[model samples]
Target: MIDQLSLTNFKAFRSADIPLAPVTLLTGLNSSGKSSVLQAFVLLRQSYDSSTLFSSGGGLLLNGELVELGTGLDVLHEDVVHTPGLPTPLISIGLRTSEGQNFNWSALYAAEQDVLTLHSASDAQRTKSVFDRRRFQYLKADRIAPATSYPKSHHQAIGLGFLGASGEHTVNYLRHHARRPLTSKPLRHPKAQTNNFLDHVVAWMQELCPGVNLEATEIPGIDAVRLSYGFDGTAGLTSSARRRPTNVGFGLTYALPIVVACLSAGPGSLILLENPEAHLHPRGQSRMATLMAAAAAAGAQLIVETHSDHVLNGLRLAVKNGAMSATDTAVHYFRRRGLQAEIVTPRIHEDGSLSDWPEGFFDEWENSLEQLLD
Candidate 1:
C-alpha cells in the first residue's frame, strides 16, 4: 500500500510528506487539508483511468469522474517554491511504497488550463499496482442520498468492482456481488448468519439500527438497480415490509456504501474514505471505526478522513481490544498554519492510548466540560 504521500506545490500544502499505515485516520478542522490528501489519491487514479497520465502527451486531468480540481492555478500552492531563476514551479506528487519503490509524477503549471502536462517516467508497473481501479475505491464526502434507484454500469460495478465516487453504483454493485463469499475472517460480522457479503452487510448495519436489513435488486428493462430496507422487531414491529431507500431515512442509505466498501476488503485493497462517520449517531460512528480496523486486519489498507471523536475513540478501543496491532494504525491531527497545512502524528500505544494530543485534537469534549465547570 502507499506507505507515504509527498506533495510539492499542491493544494493546501507547499511541501508535505504524510506517513501512512495499514489504517490511517486523518482528522482536523474544516478546510485544514484532510480532504485534500484524499483528493490527491483520487487525482492520480482519475488521471490514470482516463489514460492521460501515461499517454505520449501526458498530463494530469484536474477534472474527472472522481474529482474536479479545476485549473492548475486552483490547485497550485499560493506560496510555490522554485529554483531562483525558474519562472514556474512544477506541481509534484510522490508515492513511496512500503517496499521502498517511489513513483513520482510532476506537472507543469498552467494558469487557466485544466490539464497540466506532465514530466512522466516509465514506472508503469508500480504506478498501475497503486492506481488500478480494481484494487482501489474512493467514496467522496457527498455520497448518494436516499434514492429509488441507482445506476448500473457493468464495466464499473461488476468488471472494475467500483462502487463509484459518490456510491452512485452501489445498489447495482451490491446486487451483483451479494452472494460473493466473504473469506476475510476479520471482516465477517460475528452476528451474520451466512458467509456471504450481503448477510455481513446486514449484520453490520444492524449495529446502527437494530433489526435493519437491506437488499439490492435489478429493475427489469432498465440499466439500474434498486435498494430497499426492512426491519425485524425494530420499534416493536414483527417484520416490516421492504421499503424504498427514500422511506428508511438518510443514515442507512448514506452509510451503505461504506459498509460494502469495508466488507470488500482483502489483501492489497486500497480504500480512501471521506467522513465515514457522517450522519451517524455516536455509537454508530464508533462502530464504523471498529469496522474499518477490521478491514485493516483483513489485509486492506484504509485511509479515512473523519471529524468524529467517537470514531477516534472507537479506533482506540479497537487497538486496546486487539482487533489490530497498534503499530498498524496512525492518527494524524491536521491544522493550518498561515496558508499551509501542518500535520501532527500521534503514536498509538498497545493500550490504545495516544502518545500525544496536540491542541484542538479531539479534545473538545474535555475543553467544553472545563468551561461548563468554570
Candidate 2:
C-alpha cells in the first residue's frame, strides 16, 4: 500500500503531500482536484503497464489504458514557477509505500508533447511499486452503462484481474472468476448460499437492491459476455425469469463492477474508485462505503473519491462498528485556493468522530437544515 503521495506542479497541485491509509476518502466540491489525486496513481500504473516507465528512454504515457490525460500543458499546474536556470519546470510524482520504499518519477515539461521525457535515469530493476502489482483496479467516473453484452478479454480479465478503467471488463472477469474462493472472512456475506465468489457478490449486491441475483455467461462465438439479473419473489421479475442487464435498472449495472472489485480485493491489492455512489440511493451509497471499509479490513488498500455524504457516514459507521480502525482511514477535504488545490485532512477518532469539521466538509446537510428551520 502507498503511505503517501507527493505531487509537484502536477495538475491542480503545485506542491502537496497527500497522506494515505488503508482506506482514504477524497471529498470536496467539484473541480477541486479530487480526481487529480486518483489520476496520479493511474498515470503511473498505465505508464508502467505500457513499459514506458521502465524502458531505457521511457517517459509518462499521456494516453493509455488507465487514463487519457492530455499533453503536458493540460496537466502542468497553471501557476508553475519556472526556475532561473532550468529551461522547463519539472513535474514530479513521488510515492512512499507502506514498506518504506520511495519511488520518484520526474518528467521534463513539454507544452505540446504527450510523453514527457524522464529527468532521472530509467531503471526497471527496482522493486515493484504497489501500482505495478497485478492485483489492481481503477474504476473511472464515466463507466459502462446498461448494455446487452460487454466485451470479453481473457488477457485483461483473467490474465491481469483488471476490471478496466471504465469497468468495461467486469462481466468477463465475473464469468471467469465466479467460483474462485474468497481469501478473507470479513468479506464473506453470511447470507450467501455458498462461499464461492459469485454468491458472495450476489449477497452484497442485495444490499443495493434486495433479492437481486446476477449471472455472467459468455456469448458463444464472440468476444463478449452477458449479464442478467433475477429477483427472488413474484415482484417485478421472478428468479425463473432472467432479465438482461439492459432490462435491469441502471443502478445495478452501474454498481456491479464496484461490488465485484471490492469483493475481489485482498492483501496487496490496490483499488481506486471514483464516485462509487453514482446511481444508487442514499442507503445504498452508504452500503458501498461499508464494502470499501470491509475491503480495507481484509487487507486491501482503497482510495476513493466521492461527493456523497451518505458514503462518508457509512465509512464512519464502519469505523464505529469496529470493522476497521480509525487509524486506517484518512479523510481529505479539497478546496481551491487561487490557482492551486489545498487539502484539509480531518482525523477520525476511535468512536467514529472527526477531529474537526471544516466549513465545506460535508456540511451541506446541516446548512440546508438550518435554512429550512429558519
Candidate 3:
C-alpha cells in the first residue's frame, strides 16, 4: 500500500508531499488539480508497465509527444513561472507497506537541456544510475477503450492483467474471475467477514442493481470466457433481458472493473482511480463508495479522485456501519491558483460526516440563492 506521494514541478504542483490511507478520496473544483494527482499515478505506473499504460491510443500524451520518460514537466502546463531560478522539473513518489517497508522514486527533467532522469532511494548515493520504467501498472480514463466485438482469435488472454483507469474492461475482468473457483480456503480480512472479497463484491453489485444475477460462461467455440448478468423476469420478456452481460445496464458494465480490481488486488497492489462514480445515479454512486471502502478494509490500498458528494457520503456511511475504520480513510481537497494548487485534509467524524465543509463544497444551494437575490 502507498503511504505518501510527493510532487515537485509536476503539473499544478511545484512541491507538495501528500499522505495516504487505505482509501484516499481526492475532491476539488474544476481545474483544481484533482486530475493531476491521478495523472501522477498514471505516470508512475507507466514507468513500470508501459505496455498496459499505452495499450490504448488515448493514453498519456506529453506535449503532443508519446515519449515515456525524461520528456520534461511540460506535460503539466502552467501560465506562471515557479521558483524563478529552478532549472528542472521533478516528481517523486513514496510507498509504504503494512510492515513499514518504504520505497522512494523520483523523475527529473531539464527543459532547457531537453533531458530527463529517473531517481530512486536505492541509487541516491550513485552519481549516475540506470532507470528501468517497467515495474508498475497504470490506467488512465481517456485511454480506456470500450470492449467490442472482433475476430474470436483477437481475444486477449487473461491472468493478472491490467484494467484501464476508466474501468473499460471491468465486465471482462469480472467474467474471468467468476469462472475460477477458490483453490484454497476462502481468504478473509482481519474483521472475519463471512464472505470473501469476491463474494462481497457480487453482493454489493446485487444491492445496487437488483434482479440481476451475474455468472461466467464459456462460449462453445471460443476460448475466451464471458460474463453474463441475468435479469429476473417473466418468460415472455425480451431475449436480452434473459441473457447474461447483455441484459445489464451500462452503469454495471462501467463499475465492474472497480469491483474486480478490489477483490483481485493483493496486499501490495496500488489501485488508482479517477471519479469511480461516473455514469451512475446518486444512489449507485453512494453504493460504489461503500464497496471501495470495503475493499480498503480488506487490505488493498486505493487512491481515488472524485467530485461527487454522494460518493463521499457513502464512504462515511461505510465507516459508521463498521465496514471500515475512520482512521483507514482520508479525504484531500485541492484548490488551484494561477500556477499552484493547495491541498487540504478534511476531518472525518465517527458518524461519517465531515468536520469542516469548505466554501463551495457542493454548495449548489448557495449559487441558487445568489441568483434569486440578484
Candidate 4:
C-alpha cells in the first residue's frame, strides 16, 4: 500500500507530503486538489509501465496536453506575487510493506529542456522513460478521454488482469473468470459465496427492474462472451424477458464495474476510484461503499475520491458493524487557500465515529443557516 505521497510542482500541489493508510478517503471542494492526489498515483503507476516518460499518453494528459512538471520550489509561495524559482516538478511516492520495507519513486518533466525523467528508490540511476509506463489501473469520473480507446480493447483475453476505468467490460470479465478454474490455484471465493456474489449483483439490479437474472453465454457466431440480463414474470412465467446492457438503467452498468473490480482485486493491487457513488441511489451508494470497505479489509488498497456524504457515512457504519477496521481507514479533506491546497486528515474512532468535524465538512446546516442569515 502507498504509505506516503509527496508532490512537487504538480497541479495545485506545490510541495506536500501526505501519509496514506490502507483505505483512504479524499474529500474536498471542487478543484481543491483532491483529484490531483489520485492523478499523482495514476501517474506513478503509469511511470512504471511506460517505456519513455511521456510516451503512452494515458492518464497523464490533462486537457489534451501533457501535464507540466514544474520545479519543486516553483509551487511554493513566499507571499502575494512573490515566489522563488521552482525546482523540477518532481513527484515522489513512498510505498512500504507491512513488514516495513520502503520504496520510493519519482517523476518529472522539463519543458524547456524537452525531457522527462523517472527515478526509483533502490536504483540510484535516473533515466528517460516512454509513455507506456507501468500498469496501474484507475477508475476516474472521466475515465478515458474522448480520443482514447476502451481500456480493455488492448487485451486479447477477457479476464487476464484488465479492468477499465469506466468498468466497461466488468460483466464480461466476471463471466470469463468465473467459467475457468485458475491454473493450480484455489478459487478465492467459496462456491456458496461465489453464487451469492452473482446473485447479489443480479438482485441489486432487480430492485430497479424486478425478476432479472444475469447470464453469460457465447453468441452464435462470435467468440466473445456477452452478459444479458433476463427478466421473468411471476411463477410459471409466460415469456422470456431479457435486455442488453444498453437497455437497462445506467445505474446497473455503472455499479457493475465497482462490484466486479472489488471482488477481483488481490493484495498489492491499487484501485483508484472517483465517485463510485455516481448514478447510484443513496441506499445503493451506501452498499457500494460497504463493498469497497470489504475489499480494503481483504487487503486491496483503495483510494476513493468522493463527494457523497452517504458514502462516507456508509464507511463509518461499515467500521461500526465490523465490516472494516478503523485503523485501515483514513479520511483526508482538501481545502484550498488561494492557489495552494491543504490536506486535513480526520480521525476515526474505534466505534466508527469521527473525532473532529472541520468547518464545511459535509455540513448542510452551515449552508442552511447562511441562507437564513443572509
TM-scores, all models, native as reference: 0.97, 0.97, 0.75, 0.75
Which lDDT values do the candidates have, in the order given?
A: 0.89, 0.90, 0.59, 0.60
Residues 251-278, model 2: lDDT tens digits:
9988999999999888889899999999
Model 4 C-alpha lDDT per residue in residues 200-238, reported as the tens digit of each score: 455444543446566655545544556665666644442
Q: List ranges where model 3 is wrong by over 4 Å.
A: 50-73, 76-91, 94-102, 110-115, 119-157, 165-172, 179-201, 220-225, 234-248, 369-374
What are the per-residue Cα lDDT tens digits for candidate 1 across 49-141? Answer: 999988887888999888999999899999987845557788888899999989899888898999999865546765677775677889999
Candidate 3 per-residue lDDT, tens place, 1-374, comes to 56777766677777777888988988889888777777766564444344322232222223212224334545434543344355553445555444565556554455532323553333323311111221123334443332322112213214445554444445555555554542222223333223444455566666566555555445567544556555556345532654544444467766666666666655545677777776678898998887677666655678888888899889999888888888888899898766789888887888787888887676776789999999
User: Where's the lowest-lDDT run of ten residues in candidate 1?
Assistant: 119-128
Give me the runs in candidate 2 sitting further than 4 Å from their true place: 234-236
User: Higher lDDT: candidate 1 or 3?
Assistant: 1
Candidate 2 vs candidate 3, lDDT winner? 2
Note the clash tally of each candidate. 0, 0, 8, 22
C-alpha displacement of 147 in model 4, angstroms? Answer: 18
